[model samples]
Target: MAISITQFASDSNLLNTPLWDKQSEILEEFWAGNYAIAVWALGRRSGKTLMSAIVATYCATMLADEYKRHLRPGEKFYIISVANTIDQAKIALQGVKDLINGSPILKPLIVRETTDTLELRNGAVFRALTASSRSGRGMACPLLIFDELAHAVDTEAGNAAGSSLYQALSPSVAQFGKIGKILLLSSPWIQSGIFWDLYKQAASGNFAHMQVVQAPTWEVNTTISAEFLEQEKARDPELFKVEYGAQFTGNIAAFIDNQLVDAAINSDRGLLPPLNKFNGTYYLALDPAKGGRDAYTACIVHYDGELVVVDQFHQFAPTWGDGKKTQVAVSLVEDWILEQHKAYGFASVVLDQYNSSSTIQRLSGRVKIRELTWTASSKTEAYSKLRELFNGGSIELYPHPKANGQIKNLTVTYRPNGTWGVSGGTGAAVDDYPSALAGAVLMATNRINKQQIIPAKSYRTW
Candidate 1:
């Protein structure tokens, strides 16, 4: 007797509850025989792993039945699950194992079971593997499920292993005069990599060979509480978009969550006034363009006893001209800072490590300028701290269209070693504002309540 997926899942622990309507839709799509590829950009806790496991196990078991009855001898088939790490792979493997175990009629067919693979009486196997160059090879499998693909690291064991594995499986998937399927399931991340590319291609209807299903957390996982989604929204709006809304953030991974940036933007204030008479310590940070071609931006932050607000944001042209011309650009920046110092007392000036040495040399005695070289690790740290400040609602932003654009352009990248890198989005016109803001955030943590604000001076030394 042929056991249907419905029979195996009926009254079982795995499907004891009613299937979410969206899950039914996905299962129907998989069995529709219309699409060769399925791309799932679903939110967290949407039961992606569970759904994938059911389909993988059912297909492997059912296909083994076909091979046993009608296929030629010595032929092998497989259903393989691929994840970015061994731990992640275990998730898929565990789900499959549980479903196979919970089914009353399906348990007897398993001839052998290892930590990562299961072999049936027939020459069929169900395996879970990682996204390493050495993994997922030599398997002439029919179906492959990629779990949480956005975080798949490159340069692991040399080269892009995920891409390599895809090439290896593609031929087999299209062989045997039978249609094969590939499933890509993940949460949203930055707008890069295979996940984004394939999704866009499919959605555009440009690739008839691909199919996509994009759903928010609530739409797919009907069991989840609205309160949980609300909490995530409150915690970080940009994060909520990725986790619940299932939307691509931007070009690069946004380091500071969008909700934080949104919360900080003060719509009441347009561009900050040229100067202010506020009685707070002010810190100015400069990220200058190497030449006048790029943007040279300075951001000033005011710290009262308990609150921090961006009081002034300015962008200068790229480093301009020869010695004299360069000096003029320098004079413009220096003069502006000095004047702001008079309007609102500035305690210390923070300089980007790669900023102009000439300008620093010229302003040494006028104000305390500390230059900290920004490395990958240092930039990660500063951005992380800035994110923390925004998460806690500790920083306020004065509304300026350019500043808003720059802040939103901030992207974060993760290394295989688990370190983070923050930068502006690809092809951004200006990153200076965000860079300077990050520096100011780092300096703000060191400011003291009793610290002196450098008062307006009577004499000019420069």
Candidate 2:
């Protein structure tokens, strides 16, 4: 017996009791198939995972009878969710599983479970697949959900995630033609990628196949704390606007986009030995806290003429003794640099003359160190080199959340004098970590490039 979704929704208790107002409207728009592709740019934790699960399960179970009728003999209908990580993908899967077990009407159709999919007796399947370019291969899915399309666009899921999934699954929908559905929803990230493009297209009212919904966190989930958002706005106003205010803050202004940073992550302990342990030509960069809650930073980088790989990075904020704590922090930073130099065979050490305190003078006796002044021009140059490394895809970054977090939060700011420099973007604790890494990379490359001035065979001087 075929049952329409409206009948199922009314009787089967498909959603939670007392649904939020907008959720009802979204659900209503969803089942009506008002748009073949829907883009929801929602604030964080706006119940997107639950909504995604409801749609997937409904298409897989309640609508199974009618949708199955469209399938040719031996063809199976699929409801797929592709997310950045397995855990992310499984969230929606768990949502579907929970709903099915709770539903008296749909629970009977779940016949079996495989490693990656749940099977229904009505010839429908629900799959939770990690966003890998290869995940969509050989699937005939009519409904697809891309959770955190922004994360997918920036990380390992780049090739197989977000819009990329369309190439693989679009063919599967050839049987259903225009009836197949794709819902891409996420908290805004960079201003680039498929989600942003779809939103702009929908805004223009030019794209007939797509519709966009942009809502602040509170608009979608009224239960969210206004107090918390207010506190966060007080803490970092720019970030709050982008994250919770439903604003498409320009990602172009970021010095390092998440995609570049995600691609540069090189932490696989077994595959590639860490820089702290590996024996290689290493360069060390150190930054000192001037005052206040500023952090002291150290970053180590190695260059293979072309690629700059950061092997180690460390940073910490000084306990606020103000002037006294800064001296202690500098001493600690220098000692740590000495330890690293002894262990890793650091070839050169780079430090800003302005922030080096007496660390440079103290280390002069034991190790070779170069002191460079940090003006707007020097800072601009270092940042440019860092961008080149990322642009050329030649930077192997040590995977540290502290450093990566700073990297992602770094924004490029142009001064009145037309010089480009980097400042920590919204939600960053401090910009010291990124500055240290930039200094290390600049020194590593400069050391090698200067060597090129003297022909390799003619003179062994750099």
lDDT (0-100) at residue 63 of candidate 1?
63
Indicate the residue-level lDDT of 270 in model 1. 60
lDDT of 1 at 162: 49
Please, what are the lDDT tens digits per residue for candidate 1 over residues 1-462? 254454445546433424677887777766664577888899988998988887787677666655344345677787888887888888899888777776666677678889898877667788888877345565567787888776566564322444566666656565433446788988866566667777888789887767788999899988889898887776556567877898876644666767668888887876555345553467788887754445678888876545678877887754446743342267788888777766666666777756566677777777666665677756766676577667778788877878777777777664432244666765534677888887776666555535322221212233
Task: Give candidate 2 misplaced runs (Cα > 4 Å).
Answer: 1-18, 154-161, 252-462
lDDT of 2 at 14: 52
Tens-digit lDDT string for candidate 2 (1-462): 254443454454553334577876777766565578888888877888887877787677655656666778877888888776778777778888877878766778789876567888888888888766466766777888888776564354542356675566656655566667888888776566666777788778888788778888889899888898786665445556667877766644777658878898876731233355445478888776664345677788776556787766777556436564443356666778778777777777777765664777777777777776777667776777787677557888766887788888887653211134578854424688888888787777766777321111111123
What are the clash counts of all predictions, listed in order? 6, 2
lDDT (CA) for every model shown?
A: 0.70, 0.70
TM-score of 2: 0.57
